[model samples]
Target: MNFEIPPGLTDLLQEFTVAVLRTRPSNLEAFAADYFNNLNEKKNGPLKLSGALRFQENDTVNIIEPSDGHGSSNEDDDDDSFVGPPSSYRDRRKSVSAERYDPEADDEGDYTKVVNPKSDEQRRRLNDAIKHILLFRSLDHEQMQEVLDAMFEKIVDPGEEIIAQGDDGDNFYLIDDGKYDIYVNIDGKRKLVGNYNNEGFFGELALMYNMPRAATIIAASRGTIWGLDRQTFRRIVLKTAFNKRKKYEKLIEGVPMLSSLDMYERMNVCDALSSQTFRDGQQIIAQGDKADCMYFVEEGNARVAMVNKADPTATVEKEISRVGPGGYFGELALVTNKPRAASVYSVGVTKLAVLDVHAFERLMGPCMDIMKRNIGHYESQLLHIFGDKANISDLR
Candidate 1:
């Protein structure tokens, strides 16, 4: 029950963890669930790894590991009983539309090896296929469309291995018709674990890295599937993030406050930003509220005001400033969680690039490191600008 993970596999786990983090930032609970399942799925059947993180979907993540992850072997796990005969497979195969893909048909002028169904049913299913995964749920409608666009259909025959447990993963698959039997190898023998039918997906982790497949999936019948290669999948998954980062780069380029930073440093700041939108009358930052994030206006307008503490319900607020596209507020908040000095509200509908405290620190680490290395030089420059005795030790 206590299978020790090989030392070499540690790197694979770390790499997998980073990909999951990038795909879904700040959701450690989801990471734990997916990570453990990843290791468990790779377990050599009755012999399993015990030290992987233990968790459930809704449960709080726990760092403790169970003593044993392995379950006892069953005599009923025989491969013959699990895998039905070729004739039985043909019976199920008859349920699917064979006209969709002709085995004898040659692709004389087609761009793909598999033939797509004439109806829109496959496209609808492909869109619905990823709805259940948390990472996909984070995507907006347009971003999700990119994922669907990246995918293409593949017609597979019965008994063919869609993906083998030890093979390098280049594609993430979603079954469109028929089924696949999931199998894991234990001591060079394949053992059936489960089955995937229409809409079921696998190989999502491949979008991040080309690790070996955790389990083997064999076609139970001549079936249709939609698959996205690693390159296309990665582009879809990272499109929003990279797109926003590029947008921020352009936005930051126009901000005079960031002019002192080098291009690379400016990019670091841009990469930390996350896009946000505000409805009319929505308060972006409230007076006396903790300042944990800042915003850069992408569209529309906003008004800055100060609350009248003497008359809490006063109809008139002290209007301090008005800013539109390419403008920003809460710069001090990125450095520290101090109480906001004023309030900001959307004048109409507004879109903004927001950077929370964590992201600001993370993407700006390199810039901070450079400052740390040149602290003495910076201190002298500040002192020269002010006076010989100017205080610069606690610049934070």
Candidate 2:
């Protein structure tokens, strides 16, 4: 039968083969089968296989084809016959009886008993696959191996909720097998948001920000996953050559509007700015909606619009301006604490720093006191910006 191996699986097989050869066994075929079987029993049957070849029991003495198939023979077949100590042999027998069984027949409902034995190469492939997923696409070979030692793997059945929206997320996951669907509840209905495949990652935003899960992820099929909890992931990211938060703080301090603030107050402003991400075309702030926070553009672009009051019967949307990186918007929300005068929608993948009312209150308290002391200075500035039409009655 024709079978094709995926690039990922082939790499895994190579690793497994190396591991098995380091602890060489007498019968290569038997060792391979035993190793495969053990992995199957441990991982259940979610593991996939390809390029498998088996030998008939009676034809063991005949020359078996090597993986390269160049007519080489096993010269040590006779001399390398396995002879285990009595105690070891008995332990093996007992383990086989206790742990090796058909998952379908087991009353205990354990799912991992169905793994068939695999060749040395296949075992290596499985191990490589696990390592590859733990490291994901960003880490290099050496880093990947280190991560493999620290990571843990698990198999989950379909319909399992890996993370729930609104819950504190402490772990991030990389898919090794099967698929998953992501959803967010909108207007009382679960709306499909995204899908994940092998090597795909989710729950990263929560890990970075320590916020609640923004969406719920459900296993779409029997899946194998490699996950690292928040503590470990944090250590890895923070240990990198560049710290993202520190870099962002330095950039924010350079902005003219924030230059008046000292280093401590600037840090407080940064702390107040919550990390928010949105997909293209997603509405960030609705027109005429009660605004509670100011937003600073960190990445991507957004269109600002206000209702065109020209036609009273029909609602009109007029785009006023486009805001992008280093540009700030929604300052009115921070000051007036009133409804948003305009709506903003993402033009592409967008990241924003949102400063809410509570954060603004805390950070602006001392600054406000300073402004009150120089009331005439502030009043002149406001008058120059907004003429006689500007209302200063609300300030008192």
Q: Compare the candidates by lDDT and give the number of the best one.
A: 1
Stretches > 4 Å off in candidate 2? 1-242, 309-314, 365-396
lDDT of 1 by residue, 154-220 (tens): 8999998776554555777777778777665543456554565554566654344334455567888
> Any residue pairs clashing in model 2, and if so which?
12-124, 12-125, 13-124, 13-125, 15-124, 16-124, 17-124, 44-112
lDDT of 2 at 205: 52
Query: What TM-score would every model get versus the actual structure?
Result: 0.43, 0.35
- Candidate 1, position 42, lDDT: 35
Which candidate has the top score in TM-score?
A: 1
